[model samples]
Target: MTATPRPGRTIALVSEHASPLAVLGGVDAGGQNVHVAHLAAALADHGHHVTVYTRQDAPHLPPRVALRPGVDVRHVPAGPPRHIPKDQLLPHMEQFGHFLADEWRHRPPDIIHSHFWMSGIAALAAARELGLPLVHTYHALGTVKRRHQRQEDTSPPDRIALEKAVGHGCDRIIATCRDEVRELAAMGIAADRTTIVPCGVDTTVFTPHGPAAPRPPRRHRLLQIGRLVKRKGAALSITALTALPGTELLIAGGPPPHQLHQDPEVRRLRETARRTGVADRVRFTGGLPRESIPALLRSADVVLCPADYEPFGIVPLEAMGCGTPVVATATGGHLDTVADPATGRLFTPGDPAALARAVTALLADPARRAACGAAGRRRVLTRYGWDQVAAATWDVYHDVLALHPSHPSRGRSEVTPGPAR
Candidate 1:
């Protein structure tokens, strides 16, 4: 048998908070974690040796676990060997960067790609010290948050400014949508340094004609998946369900219902449903296994996403892949993904009345729903599959490596260069 040459050497993925192995179906298992994990597996399939570094949240977690043939997870010791929320992980970036630097001292990876703000901070610091090429993907921008939230936003006061710095400092910014490129430019990130690479879905798993598992029989089922946060706009969907009689709204995210009562957002959602006289129609599924999400989507008549803002909403994409139509707000990435009158309907963000009207119209017409679902599945498979996303990301890595080769002191190639480069 002939030997196959390697493809541009090893690459490191830095994700401080979201571990690839962590169960999805929680408050934090929205987009970033899925993007990183799927992207790594896809990249590995393309013959790249990939190593994902995430903060170790449990002592029992192995130091390394193979995801695919060429992909591995590396649990780096940062703060405590226990779970810590994303909001509390900022102070440990310096330690994360130091650990990364030490890891690179002996077995250096060709390039480092970081996900989220704190990961970007740690990766940038480590890259600067090691003279390594760095690529960053900020799942959500702070500038956008401040613009959307104004005074009510509870994010750290300095998040906007710090995110701006990360965007400008990184070797290249991976904008998940064209809208994000505009947001980055507004925050002073050079347009030329930004590449638009949207997150992708696994079409093989989220197919249109698959046999969906049995779901509770209801007059009609409307699904909403993601965190129970103000930005997610789940409460708006719950309120809208009241106007559409006989429709069962299943919310799939967050902890169990008992634990949910402890959350202010969950309580607010319950209150909104009661005020709208739809509390009985809405059911919170709490958190379900990630493997079970596709089946859930397949059984839904319509998927609802009323997020106030999103860099790229993966829930709608997942629904689309499962041959399900969506009713999402025309904000941020939703405007790019959902084609009005084609794949699904779109309404103004924060307008429950408008959202209710859209959902009502979809529920009234079964043929229209079928047609839209077919179109949505075709759209995702054609343009937003994991293969396409992985290739695009690899291209970015190659471009960065071509621009910067060996360190000034090392004088040897850290990452293999193409013949011409």
Candidate 2:
């Protein structure tokens, strides 16, 4: 067990990967980046001093960026101050942990919340040295990944075991979905410390419109956004398009086209499309600026997310916020976010036939699609807004503090109380 925060205690967020300011055009900058960025800003809005430490991906960068009134991004030097693929960064956790330990020697955080496994290792190391209370969120559990990706698992075999250890060792584990809670329990994590918090969306940016420009007559636009990877189910989405005639699938992600042919996922997806006989209908737009995503969602008739595993499905939430109905796999956060037959539909994971049915049904019926899209917009406003998500997170922090007092889990030293709001 660990001590809770004292009154006006400052907190540190350890995300060895996923820099808040990094562009989301790479394999690493997917959901975790959005999760940490939004959570930190939201927590700051609630009057808690927050310092988010991420690997420095560039040289000559400021040590901190005041993201909001109280939230700041601290670019820590772990490896080279340049982009390093996340999988390759695991071996550098020791260096990351040491950097945090050094930083805490002068100014320690009251509570440490680490995101992902490597970050958790860094957090655990720093906490062990300073007696800081640690909470962890395994954005994508290795066990879950192995099960979904199976023979395709690129993660080291020890990844699952390491994740399991972290899940059990942390003072508390924030499981993004109830299913994950069950999975954690099965993996030997304490059931008492687990909290279910779904990833949130900016509903203000993604809302339904009055009569969307009538989608192309005789041709439906289906959008699938995210890193183009096997685990993300990009290949499955392309295959589903084969079931719907005159349906054009737009795949948005990956580096620029000039450099895309070298990326394995992009090349694989293109090959899959050709093999499935839908290559003509599939368009890999590569990575577009994040700001352009809403318009892309609004223009599409249906958003496809057939991901095999999602700790929390942000894409579906973003689509729903944009008044675009989603057809996602009934797994992970998708189970919690998308209501089958209501806001959107869910198909069995990895089942191209099931996905085809759901997508084809949505594409063929304009009235049903419109109704579902409207419902999705309403749901996001009521549940997934950043304000609401932040408030809930604050409650968790307070609860932890109230439950433990003597331990003073602020690591070895205490950070100077800075303005967080």
Candidate 2 on 1-421: residue-level lDDT in tens?
A: 2223233568788888888776675787888888888898777766678899998888899988998777888888877887787777776777788888889978878788899988987777777766667778888888888887788777765676667666655677777888888888888776887977778887776666533433456778999999876678989888887888888988888787678888988888888889989998988878878777888889898999988888887999999998899999988899999988998898898899998898888877899999998899889998899887766665566665555435544322222111112
For model 1, residues 164-272, the per-residue Cα lDDT tens digits are 7667667788989889988888887779989888999999988876677566675888999987778888888887776788888888888765687787777888888
- Runs with alpha carbons beyond 4 Å of true place in candidate 1: 1-8, 213-218, 405-421
By lDDT, the best candidate is 1
Overall lDDT per candidate, in order of appearance: 0.83, 0.80
Worst 10 residues of 1 by lDDT: 412-421
Error of 2 at 421 (Å): 44
Question: For model 1, how many clashes?
Answer: 0
TM-score attained by model 2? 0.90
The residue pairs that clash in candidate 2, if any, are: 130-411, 130-412, 206-321
